[model samples]
Target: MEKIKTLNFAGYFRNFAPILLLFFITSTGFAFQDDRDFNEYSGEILNNKNGKAISSAYLSLNNSNISTVSNTDGEFSLKVPKDLMDATVTVSVLGFQSKTLPLDFFKVEGTEVRLIENVEELSEVTLYKATNARLLVQDMLAKKDENYLSDESIMTSFYRETIKKGWTNVSLSEAVVKIAKSPYNSSKKDLVSLYKARKSTDYDKLDTIALKLKGGPFNTLFLDMMKYTEYVLRDEMLDSYNFSFDQPTKINDRYMYVVDFKEIDESDPWYYGKLFIDAETSTLVKADYSLNVDDKKKAEMMFVKKKPSGSKVYPTELNYQVDYAQNGDKWHYAYGRAQMEYVVNWKKKIFNSKYKIDSEMVVTNWEKYAGDNWRSENTLIRPNIVMVDDVSGFNDADFWGSSNIIEPEKSIQNAIDKIKRKLD
Candidate 1:
């Protein structure tokens, strides 16, 4: 009897300890499970009138932190707490009236939000040239940030133009470049000759020239000149010109402020034109200006340079135009056009190079890769072509240089490396 009683006491104690531990763990797990359960929904926006997909529309929850934009295909997915079953959702787009609906409007699984068209109020404001337009332009230019001058600055862009004369076309291109600090102290190389039919092919003669440009005088001089020109334009043209503001206009559902500028001094190299800026982002949307090329001295010097037999001089009465579109939270160039007419004098022969060059560049695609703020890997889709016509000259050979003279691979690689340094 005594042995039996003692065995029962130990057995009961051991059984109770395990049971208590198990209960504690089960309770803790249940608590965590409750916190982890969240409800999510996928949805789309549609034009109520047409029943078509609506893209770039903003969607947000009334009480929660969830918010997102519709994709190009007009589709979206969002997650929220299950307890938000009674919350409200709001959707909005520019030029369209906003809509708000209770969560109960859609079944918990997926929802379709309908947006109605909104009538915008029109303003009637007459725009005339302001007396202080020149002064206003100067002030704006002076206030331009110094970051614009840096090679690594995000605002840098590539520009190429094809001048079409009477019948033949040629390429005369320049890029808004930024100069980066380099490891090697090399000189600048000569222009690598490229083939007309296969522009990607580089000429061999430019090999020594390209290598010598590692830290060369030509590159240094070129960069210095570009920076100086930009600085001068911003300080003298933008800061000194007067402007007249016009009524706001709508572009891609964004409000924009339009301003016209005129030069204070006709002799100034400043362009006279109109500028459009996004009211919300304060970013430039468009700029259309006419430049004066009346400086006989500058024009003569530029014309005297023997532009390869086929190449023509830069245009006079140049019209510079730029258009922009939004990319995520940033603004980027959508399209650009530069038209000018120049007189080329080669071998004492007066050749009227009346040229119109246009370039249509678009961001066909983009992707994010690994890197830091100092550097990044980006691929660009550029569809570019150059058309040049010799309005005055009849010789087609004058425009055709020896093809395959420069190594295309080396020239392109060098150009890319130079761009990377500036970006850094």
Candidate 2:
């Protein structure tokens, strides 16, 4: 967790529209434009048995790096060059049967995709001999080099961050970025360059204060614990937590050893979470974790960077989820999401307000680094750059023209409509 910068919009009413520009030296959009350069496939992923939405499922192209994650409603829209229409697409999730079809199978009007629960895969799974979850986790960490990406590459990712007052959104920011990704075997950090960005914020509705997540997409990127071990778990940091076996499970078609972990060391901030490891390869497939908000002070330290002297903020929720997708024999970051909620207790206010902030990103495309070394210092985004401050309004047609992004959930869609109305 980098930092969650909290700023007070005390004078929001003083100006109808005030643009906030936040820059930290150390730190760090919707509507379909008809894109001629690429073809768009739209679909809703549903559970075959019950017809339920499956959120965060991975939808990707075959034999290519293009990919996108399903939204909260199990809806997705993926874009690829017109020439790739003959390529295949696969939709997969944690406990569902993966489905693959020709790219042309999806209608321009959108397609309905249903995945069966992987019950067959789990039918005789429990019959296997039990193994130690802790050891499985250790082994997953030990084999990271062989199981994950091995070459330096450049990745194109779609990133978004939003803040809501309970269910109503106060801000929405999105960007298409190019990341100079370091090899998983190396300790080097990834560098990001902004390609295109757009934002819409309803500051007037925020009442008196605004909560902003610092580092934007970097918050979720750091949750790639397999690559950046210090953020969560590492070989040497394993001793700080307690690990135990949960019920074994299956992801896609592969067997997985599920393990739950909890912080036991009082010397550090507490956390509890689960790790899904590939049974055969001992590779980590997914990680779901959160800060133990039992300690108010510790949770605050992890999120709150600054706030007004007159207000007290208490974090109610802080959690993260990161998933990996396979390319050949090695896996790389596919999708990541971070969510947080907190209550603001103003000194003189009679009622406290609770606000939730959510950020998610998925790597849509990537390839080995080549051609011009585009690492010019001025062309990159700082780790703590506040994206909402840097971009304004949903006025860019070019942004929607080429990016493959998660479909906005219904609530967020409605929020955007209302904000657009007000701005109009």
User: lDDT of each prediction vs. the true structure?
Assistant: 0.39, 0.76
| Candidate 2 ranges with C-alpha deviation above 4 Å | 1-21, 24-34, 121-123, 126-130, 266-268, 390-393
| Candidate 1 structure quality by residue, lDDT tens digits, 288-338 | 666565774554343222234433344355555555444445443333444
The candidate that wins on TM-score is 2
TM-score of each: 0.40, 0.89
Q: What value does the lDDT take at residue 183 in candidate 1?
A: 11
Model 2 Cα shift for residue 44 (angstroms) = 0.7
Off by over 4 Å in 1: 1-160, 170-197, 200-237, 302-314, 345-353, 372-424
**lDDT at 238 for candidate 1?**
55
Q: Candidate 2 clashing pairs? A: 27-382, 27-383, 27-384, 28-382, 28-383, 28-384, 28-385
